[model samples]
Target: MITYIEELTDQEREAIREAIQLLYRQTYLLERRYDRRTEKYQYTKEYRTCSTHLEFLKDYFAVAGISLEENVHDGIIYIQGETLWGEKLPRLATVYLLILKLIYDEQMAQAASSTRIVATAGEINQKAGAFRVIKSIPSPTEMRRTIALLKKYQIVEPLDILEELNENTRMIIYPTVNLVLSGDHIRELLESFSEEENSGEETAIQNTIEDLSE
Candidate 1:
């Protein structure tokens, strides 16, 4: 039996437990292997090793039906797939959902363990097979055009995905999830905008952003 007595966040501990519960049967039990040569009791969980944990996350996304791709601009993980809400989710929104669900919420915020990653184009290509086959993966040029259109029109306000970085940095970070017209609250927001807003720029921008991003 491998034992690891360490300070873990509630979520972190739960993730490990889940990994053990879910993956142990297919994979081996995650042993806290002791290096007899060094005589040190390892504190980290071990199942199988890979070049990057993101590779494992790549598999994880596959289990969830979101195809992850690489972005040339920032080299972070990109997603192309259907939305969890049944509406078509854009690559940005898909990625945001995966990050929110699997990585940030389940793995980071909930799980105590830290599995670090920085996404790349090559790995994304290997992992994003489904999206590519489905023609959902957008080219780099398309991504740029969509972002620019969104900014110009005001369909969605860009939140700082990379808060500390200057605007010159191409790192785009913001909630990609937008309220569609069918949403009640979104209708209210649109009504409010129509009443007070002088610029039709917002409407034009929103539609263009959705068209291009999707």
Candidate 2:
């Protein structure tokens, strides 16, 4: 990896460095992403850079005890490792994530033609309530923080100004959500929720912001 980087032009080397930083910060790089400004999907330069130098990037992350995995079919590249300590999300944020994953799954199951799945905050809250995940809707402040957190992790992107966010506010749920929580994990969580409801015992859901440094 070092020799490969050394052989690159200065500009190329800089691009690689920037791409590495982006991956470290966002955890995932998609070949294409939703462009809020245009309301369309567009190819990502960072993803192209990463793809062009996959071997070097893998070696670069591997040295830090991180493993980089890519899904060509999904056009996603994400990193994972025990060394990547993640922030524990607040209960409300965790609930929102679960709801978003469920929404994504349902939409994909319908054979939606677009890779980008759009949903509204109202739908998220409704599903949370319908699934009995929360006793009441989260406060705007909590919702704002949750959205910001999810946005930072590249899980969801708000379509409108964040300050104006409300039940009707729409957002794009990124495919990265699938990598974060697998189908089996979602089923396990739902089953746990069911058990909690039956026992009437509040259990803290274990959810962490992945592929991030502490």
Candidate 3:
């Protein structure tokens, strides 16, 4: 593994180092080159570098009991390992994630015939409101932060940032959102939400990362 890593130029080595740091920090890496909606960037080249030196990554992560995974089809790379309940998303982020997963699933199932699901900020707000996942549309600042967080996690892609936080602002919620919440988890969440709706105990909620054992 060291042999391969040592063969790379200093710049390539730095790029790989940065990529690994990012993966460890966010646990997800999405190659912009793979996204048809975005232009190419240095990330894809760096991603290839890591891919070429995959053995190094595997060996490095194995010590920590983390698995380095890549899906060429999805254009995403991620590190999967143990997760603590306390390490999970805050209530607001978790709620938004669930809502986006639901939207992605619904869109894929219909006659749309497209794997990609495009939704406007207003549509998300309306659907989330209808499901009572949130009391109201998140404030612009809050949504901006949430979107940033999601983008970092390879969950969503926003085409334009100039006119963000508005009703017409469109974003592409990736299929990775589905990975965050398994089908069973989604069912459990919906069931829990429904019971809360009847019982008026919206405050009671489950932690997503609680079940992940590292």
TM-score per candidate: 0.23, 0.80, 0.76
If both were scored by lDDT, which would come out higher, candidate 2 or candidate 3?
2
Residue pairs with colliding backbones in model 3 are: 82-214
TM-score pick, better of 1 and 2: 2
The digit string of per-residue lDDT tens for model 2 on 1-214 reads 6688789999888888888888776567877767778988789888988899998888888898999889988889888876664455666766677778888988998974756688999999888787777777888888889898888777888888779988999999988788666654563565355324434322122125221111
Q: Which candidate ranks first by TM-score, i.e. highest?
A: 2
Off by over 4 Å in 3: 33-43, 83-88, 111-114, 162-164, 191-214
The TM-score that candidate 3 achieves is: 0.76
Q: Global CA lDDT of candidate 3, please?
A: 0.65
Worst 10 residues of 2 by lDDT: 205-214
lDDT (tens digit, per residue) of candidate 3 on 71-127: 777666777776511234555566667678778887888945646577777887786
The candidate that wins on lDDT is 2
Off by over 4 Å in 2: 112-115, 185-188, 191-214
* Number of clashes found in candidate 2: 0
lDDT of 1 by residue, 1-214 (tens): 1133145456655664554343322221222323334644343332222112335545655776765444332222333345332223344433222222222222234445633222222233333332331134445554444444433222222333323323232322222222222122322232233212332232221112233222
Alpha-carbon RMSD, candidate 1: 18.2
